[model samples]
Structures are given as structure tokens and as C-alpha cells.
Target: MQRVAIVGPGGAGKSTFAQALGERTDLPVVHLDRFFWRPGWVETPRDEWRQRQSELFAGDRWIADGNYGGTFDDRFALADTVIIVARPRLACVVSAVGRSARFHGKAVQAAGCPERFQMVFYRWIWNYDRDSRPRLDIALARHDHLDVVELSTRMSMTHFLESISVR
Candidate 1:
């Protein structure tokens, strides 16, 4: 599919999945986390963020991975397919902790935002499904015309990608 939008809670591997999908489909990949977070964990201004998102989504083919709550409509409007990586909470928590340990204080993107542990972030992950899913679902419901794929485990993501490779 062209113009894929990948979304999920932190540690859900949305970036990884976007890369894999981009490689398989020969689409450009955009990791929103890189642009959204400025150096030292600062956030890009809302107006700038939306403008950047618009430019990124204007592409003919792309795999953008991130959930910038306010820009769902922008991405969904241009995307032909939407994928949600909903791995289990425990798995997500463990993965996030490991990621922070590995990249702690190291700039992982052009924005120079280093990974760090924040109780607030963990809390968001812990309650993502119960708290954020409703909003996400509502957003998705607005784009019923787009193809939606729900992946809840690593195996499921793998299988989905493999299915694509086979095509």
C-alpha cells in the first residue's frame, strides 16, 4: 500500500515496523519522533509540527510512524493504509525500559533528543489502551475508507510483513 501511517503507544515498535514496511514497499520512511522532539526532549511548536507533518504527508509514497495526536487527520487523509502495533503492555514496558537503557543520554535522531526514563511516559504506556485507545479508535473511525491493520504481537507484525513480502 502507498502512504502508510503507523501508530501505537511508546515501545510498540512503530518505528521498526515502519522501516520494515518501507523497505518492503520501496517507500520513503519518516519517523515523526525524530522531528517532533527537539534537543533535550523539547517539543516542536504545534504549528511547526503540523506544518512539518503536512510536508511529510504530501509525498506520493511514505511510511510515517508516530502518533502526533493532533495530526491523525492529516496522515489518515493521505494514507491508504493504517497500521496499529498493539503489543501487550508488559512487553511494551520491558521493551521501553531496555530502549532507554540502551540509548540513555545518546542522541537517537537529528533532533538530539536522548532517551530517558520518565514515570509519566511509563504511566502513559501502562494506561495507553484503556485511556488513549478510545481517542485513537475515534480517530480511526473517521477514516473508514482506509485499510486498517491491527497487530498485537511481534509474530503478528512479522507475519503481516511476510505476507507483504510474498506479494
Candidate 2:
């Protein structure tokens, strides 16, 4: 899995998994959040974001994590493997909220974006399966050529990591 792509609802540990996989494989890890948001949580312009993604994908090896569907094709096109982190909605919600709380008012690992409460953000995570899964499924189908792995639990994630070629 030289070029890996990871996607999942917010707080599904996509970033954490990507980091772990990158560490084991000695591949570069790109947290899409770092590039997607500007300071104060502003989003990058679409065109610029797409171009940035293209540049990120130009590398020979990396483990990139995020569900930036806008650039799914751009990343998936070059990815050898795509992982779907599939924690339950409740779990995802909890994790996301906790992460935000931990970084509240501080610079988020995601760029310089500051963390704060936003019901809309929490609501989206709450309803992600209903509202976002369909689109994610469609994107995955479009990239059926790549190897897909779904990790629904922590143990599964751990086992999958160990099974991969760890440096």
C-alpha cells in the first residue's frame, strides 16, 4: 500500500489510522485537514484545493486521509489501496466532540483552524450515515479498480495494520 487513500465520516479515526499506517510503512502521511482549512476554519477555494491535492498525489508514496469527495478521483486515481474507517455513528460523534474539546480555542491539528462547538458540525456527524454514505459509496464504486479495506473496529484496525508490510 504505497499510495493509500483513507475516507470516512468525521472522527472515524481516519487521520489516526493514516498516521499509524504511515509510521509502519515509512510512507509520508498527508492529513487532508491540514490543507483543507485555513486559519479560523476557512475552507480553501475549490480550485486551489484540487490543485493542491493533485500535487500531493504526484508523490510516489503516501498515506492520505480525508473524505474530500471533491478530489476523490484525483487521489483515488493514483492510490493503490483505499481504506474506509467505519466506526459507529455514536462512536464517531463522541470522538469528534472529544477531539474538538481537547483542542478548544487552540490550533487544531487540521491547519491552524481553531476548535469550537458547532451543532451543525455535530449534527452532520450524527446524520453522516444517512446523508453521506450514499455519496461515499458512489465514489468507492467509481474507483473499483483499487483495493478496498473496511475497518469497523479498533481491533480490526490494529490487525490490519500489523498485517500490512511494516518497515
Candidate 3:
């Protein structure tokens, strides 16, 4: 049983990659956003978030997708591999804005909906450019020895998974 973690700046398609990997591996995938964000897009209490992460990491096999700095050490300690999806700044921002526009004014099926600006996608595109990249860099450096699969394109993502056959 291997615990895999996929982390990247917002709008880098981390969740999309995690979902595809979940379908391929048949393992439960946890989106850290669900644990960190409450309904209405409020930030969950730090203690509560840590507790939730601890519970999720208790499992022997799973995939976690997010770059929450608070629990980075804990998750890295439990992970067998880490996948980071990074793209150029402009690309990340454009994809983020487009996705937000696409999902806007729709009933959100997830536990949380994009809040006013933070969740608006375009705003996050800018926010991530300034903050998310630094957080991911810290996480990656802290776990330098972990098997890191770095992917930037959808084709590479698909090919990476296709190469791994779950027995």
C-alpha cells in the first residue's frame, strides 16, 4: 500500500490529476480543500484541519491532493511518493480563470463553493502566482528524497498513469 501525494499551485490541475489517478488505482483520494474549506468557502480551524488530515493519513493506501502548508510535514512523512503538477504562471492563471468562469453560477457539487473572490478562479489565479508556488517549493524541498513525479502537461499526466498498471 502506497500513500501518494499530489501538490501544486492552484489551477495547475492537481485535483483533476488526482481524480484520474483515483480511477486508475481504485484508492480513495482526499482533496485537502474539502478538509480545509467549510461551506461558504470559510477556512476551517487549523486544529480541525490537522485532525482531519491525521484521520485521512491513518489509512494505509490513499492519494492526497493539495498543498496545505500547515500539514505538509505530516503528509510528507506518510507519503511514499509525491507528484507535483506545475505549469508556467500564465498558463496556470488562464486555466484557473477559464475553469472558474465555466463553473460559475452553477450549483457546486463539492462540499464548498468558490467564495466571493478567493473562489472566483481568476482571483486565485493571481493569488496562487504569488503564494502557492512558494508553499509547494517548501513542501517539495522538505521531502526531497520522496519519489517525485513532476508533470506539467495533460499528455504527460496520462502517459505517466498509463505506464503504471495497478496489479
Compose the digit string of candidate 2's lDDT tens values, residues 1-167. 78999998888899889988988999999988888898878999999999999898898999898988777878888998989998998999999899889889887666677788888988988898898878878877888789999999989999998998869
Higher-scoring candidate on lDDT, 1 or 3: 1
Q: Candidate 1 has which clashing residue pairs, if any?
A: none
Superposed model 3: Cα runs more than 4 Å off = 107-109, 112-130
As a TM-score, model 1 comes out at 0.95
Would you list the C-alpha lDDT of every candidate in the order shown?
A: 0.87, 0.87, 0.77
Where's the lowest-lDDT run of ten residues in candidate 1?
A: 106-115
lDDT of 2 at 52: 93
Cα lDDT tens digits, model 1, 66-104, are 977778888898899999999999888888889989988
lDDT of 1: 0.87
Question: What is the TM-score (0 to 1) of candidate 3?
Answer: 0.84
User: Which of candidates 2 and 3 reaches a greater TM-score?
Assistant: 2
Q: Predict model 2's lDDT versus the native.
A: 0.87
**TM-score of each model, paired residue for residue:** 0.95, 0.95, 0.84
Steric overlap count per candidate? 0, 0, 0
